[model samples]
Target: MDLALKKQILQKAQDWFVESIAQNHIKNTEKLIKPTEFKINPFTAVYLANFLTGNSNPESIAKALVYPRVLGTSITTSFGTNIQKFTSEVLSAFGSTTSGIDIEFIDQLDGFKKYCQMKSGPETINKDDVETIAKHFSGVLNLAKTNSLRIAHSDMIVGVLYGDSGDLNAHYKRITSEYHFPVYDLSPELVPFS
Candidate 1:
């Protein structure tokens, strides 16, 4: 990443950490929720520390916070499935069968899939692998990261709206008005049996 992009990402990460902490505090009070009652099961302290310090193991941090393990597993599984489909599509687009692919690129793709699946494993995904996958896919990783962040932040807003007993339609209108992004009443249409 360029210096400017790195700075932007770091800034965004920090902002997200701060906002998450604030949201957690507000939810704790508003919902009359004891610390133990948090549905997500993650403590903000460990989560924020992992993001800010970058020294802590993320999985260990998640464990310490009692973060929902299933979420990570689901994300990893979804990513793996998508990657498999993407790899096949890319190979087909290149007019080459998977069997005829160069060994080096094939090895890289296998490693990438393994890396995605090992989200909960002790082995961290290599930065080189991330870069390689990002480069190979013509910015798909960049798009994914951007979309993921937007979804997470929007989900936070949805939580706030629900907790406050705010009008769902009004909240949706406000989100669209402020961000110009249509967020409400949107359900992804997944292909059947994909």
Candidate 2:
């Protein structure tokens, strides 16, 4: 990454971090307590636990009801989305997303175009997600062949925004080891890797 783009990404990341703090601020606590897409409010389990603990005071009851909301789920979700967006924006300076992948960038050292699917972190995926990623890469490869697009399977990369190769999760390792896909971490070159 060049210095200018790196600065842009870092600035955007800081902006997003500030916005996330706003969501959980005292005046914005309602945003935290809002019902999630999959989880409904008024969890009887929390109420039951509070009852068992004999902290049945009104303030204690309210705190128990709202505790899970303030656990930083929104921050995690926002970080994942914003990180991908900034990476895509920066990589767009190198190549376009014309190949039907998330983004493509010209490798500064090798001078080859790299097709990428940006992931937030190593732990962001699961078993099924691994297979789905393979299928997407294969689909793009097939499309490239049909159109005489000079692309290689090796050009496909799973770009992880966080976590070094040493501490990578099993899913990321499987992408490279079992699925024949390369996992690249977006970090300084000083990190250790095999």
Candidate 3:
């Protein structure tokens, strides 16, 4: 990525991390949640990135106090999921028009609009997960036909980004080989799957 674009992504991701911490709320406080060994908070990820890129700022550390761990593992996991999805959506805007099954830009450069399913890492997927994904695609296909949207079967792709480094690349390759859909590993250059 270009320097300007990379900087923009980092800034936006950090902003998102702060906002997420401030607004975090659990619907069910009654439910017990045990803290896990994993420290997967987005703020932590952002801090790591900032450290690696030599972009450290006091604001990043000051906001760390608000990093919600009240719900422990549940809160951390939820925040991680939110940030990953948010980052992926923002990144997608740099190139493609990411959307649901509502419409399709048929005459675009790629000839057809793409529907992407993004994953944070090379985490294991079960058979049921695969089946559920297939069902989701089938639903979207049906929805597209019902709405008279122009799309092609070949426009669908599975995108894997930010994963655990040791296994991230391997996971990406495994996922791509396991499924028929084309997969793109868009993990940042410095951190493959942080």
TM-scores of the candidates in the order shown: 0.21, 0.72, 0.50
Backbone collision tally, model 1? 0
Candidates 2 and 3 compared: the better one by TM-score is 2
Off by over 4 Å in 1: 29-115, 118-194
For residues 1-194, write the lDDT of model 1, one tens digit per residue. 35775576556545643554444444433543234544443466566546655645755554434333233543444444333333233222122222211111212222221111111111223435333322433333345476773222221111110111132334334433553322211111111110
Please provide, for model 2 over 57-133, each residue's C-alpha lDDT reduced to its tens digit, 9 standing for 90 to 100.
65665555556445456556655656655664433433345443566777666677878777777678888878988
Compared to the true structure, candidate 2 yields what TM-score? 0.72
In candidate 2, residue 178 scores what lDDT?
88
Worst 10 residues of 2 by lDDT: 185-194
Residue 142 in model 1: lDDT: 43
Q: What CA root-mean-square deviation does each model show from the true structure?
A: 21.3, 4.3, 11.8
Query: In model 1, where is the ten-residue run with the lowest total lDDT?
Result: 185-194
How much lDDT does candidate 2 score? 0.66
Pairs with backbone N, CA or C atoms under 3 Å apart (clashes), candidate 1: none
Q: Write the per-residue lDDT of candidate 3 for residues 78-160, one digit (tens) a residue.
A: 66567444644445433334343211223234555656565655564455655555555566667778999865555555555
Model 3 segments more than 4 A misplaced: 22-72, 92-112, 142-149, 164-175, 186-194
